[model samples]
Target: MRRAFPWLVLFLLCLGLTPVVFAQSQSELDELRREIAELDEKIDAAEAEKSAVAGDLAVAQEEFYEAAEAVDAAQVKVDAVQAEIDTEEVQLAEIELDLDTFKTALAATEKELTETETRVVDQTAELYMATATQAPLVFEFTDTEEIALSSAYVDDALGNSAELAASLEGLRDQADRERVSLAGAREEQQTLLAALDEKRGRLQTEVDALDEVKQVEAAEMGELQALVDGINANIAAAERHKDGLEADSARIEDELARRAARQREEEQQNDGGGGDGGGAPPPGANGWVRPVPGGVSSGFGYRTHPISGARKLHTGLDMSAGCGEPIYAANGGTVVTASWYGGYGNAIIIDHGGGVATLYAHQTSFAVGSGTSVSAGQVVGYVGTTGYSTGCHLHFEVRLSGTPVDPSPYIP
Candidate 1:
């Protein structure tokens, strides 16, 4: 066991300061407990906040993913619409090329038709003149065979003109039909192109909208994640602080435990060699024995003060003892005082029930408290040099009716 601080014990006994010291210690312990409780509350609050923030962060992340998926879906739709637009554009280009071909053919057919009509009109006029004047009748011919040949030639000429005119009309009709078909195809393609463009526009709009939503949700996720981090940080800090406080509390508790254990040990050691009527040493003439193993170094009478250099009544016998050596009770008695008294630092007084008391002073520490019964040879305290002392020893005294007397008559 560690030795007690004798000076501290002396100071405590001297000025009635033990209770104040203990009260301060108790107050400190209580403060530590209160701070620990408060820290626990803070930690709990921080954990709750962290949990809530984490939940929000999770929700935000889920929403972000959903928005990203929507964006992907919208992009796919836009791509599909663009593909349709490209196809429609190709078809429209082909229809335009067909329309141009049909237009050229129709124009050429109209020109041919016009030229054939003019030729037919001229032929009719020529034939009418011939009929009116009968210019084709054998007047232009030298013989009947020549006249027959001319009539055959005129008939072939009229037949060939009529056939050519009819062929030109049929070609015109065929070209007109092809031109109408090409125009219908071009119109349908243009209509489809316009519708595709409108659909692509709407799909692009949807894509842009979904993309915007995705951006917003992503940003929210970031903020919520940051919040979760901050909350976790707070919780971690609270836990660390709580741990520190708990460590301090544990230290204080350990100190208190040590003190209590020391106290119990001291009590057992002090009471070990004694009972009220048993284990006592054989008493001398007045039921007393030597209080310490160290015999008397100075007797109880005035010669000169060792510290003051003046003659005075020495109140006790200075018994030689090493520092921290136990001082025994001279007889079975009740302890009347176990504290400091003036120049007698860390002293004890025991009354033996007949206006007779024994004093043991300048002790390092007390083994028993006041009002305790002790037997002869039972340990009362350890020796020390305190007030008005030059070295470690016990100042032993015997008192009768509150007056100090020589202790030699009482102890052997």
Candidate 2:
């Protein structure tokens, strides 16, 4: 009877262990199911992010095309105005040559008139001398041969004097008319020169304006190109992230399935086992806080560049702050980049897991290093006016799957 009692005690102990083992298996199964559900949610979020990035890329491409076209049109206008200026310059040169010719002709005409006046003065003096030296002779003497000869001599002298005076007078009138005509030609030349000058001025002004327009257009095109490049980079990064997420989800699913199978087998093997277990904590929250405490000096969207005056996309928020002001991390993440970046100055980029990231730009100094872990509100850098910044401020950005999105919603 004592040996039978010992067997019964061992049997009761085995029965007590069975439910504990089965309860442990059930707990494992529930954990796997929760993990699978989280993976499914992550996949859905990744898909939506990809779609958004694609749309932004398309908009950026269209803007680039439009900017290029504007640059082309401005260049054409500049060329046309320049051409008009060149034509006007040529015409001005020809007109100047014609004016020189007119001036030379006028000088010759004045010289001729002066010479004619001098000749007339000399001839009049000679006629006066002849008349003073020769006495008035009356042809009353009865000598017919002498009378006829004297009469013929006097008549010929009178006829010669009258012809000389009349020719001089006609020469004077012709000189006066030539002078008037030359004056009119000079006046016309002056008018033409003034008109040509005005035309040149107008054309030059147009050319200058067009040149300015072209410069602005060119600047806008360059900005657009940069924007397109950024969008392309974002798209590439997003695609890679999507692929990674998908792979991760697949791996997680496989792991969950394996764990579920193991749990089921364990439960079947220990149908009499019983236990209680706890589940893991839920996934981390998805959101961000402001990197700096200040009002936004510049908002995200298209705006005219203050320095370049070109319309361009402002991809991030510019928080106004004093130089050397501390900049905080927006969320918990691993710093992927911490160094000088083109146009961004001393920039820092953090990967916050689940395809989320944040950027801090134009910093005077860095407080964090690459590959270092950081927590929300941790100082990562200082505000500065480095690189292309117009003032001391923090350029904060939030990226979902590497695509820049408006950071306003994420900020508290």
Cα-based TM-score, every candidate: 0.46, 0.38
With a 3 Å backbone cut-off (N, CA, C), the pairs that clash in candidate 1 are: none
Predicted structure with the largest TM-score when compared to the true one = 1
Worst 10 residues of 1 by lDDT: 15-24
Residue-wise C-alpha lDDT for candidate 1, range 133-212, written one tens digit per residue: 76556455578877676576567557758787678779877987887788888888888888988988998898899889
Clashes of each: 0, 9
lDDT of 2 by residue, 1-412 (tens): 0011223233223223211111223233233222333333333443454455445545555655665566566556556656765676666567666657756765776676677667666666666456546744533446996567556655655566676556657766776676676667656666665665676566556556655655655565555445445444544544454344334433443454365456645964787542211111122245455687789989999999764466998888989888756678887889999876756756999999899888998776676689988877776766765545666789988888978889888887
For model 2, where is the 10-residue window of minimal lDDT? 274-283
**Regions of model 1 farther than 4 Å from truth:** 1-33, 117-160, 243-412
RMSD of 1: 22.3
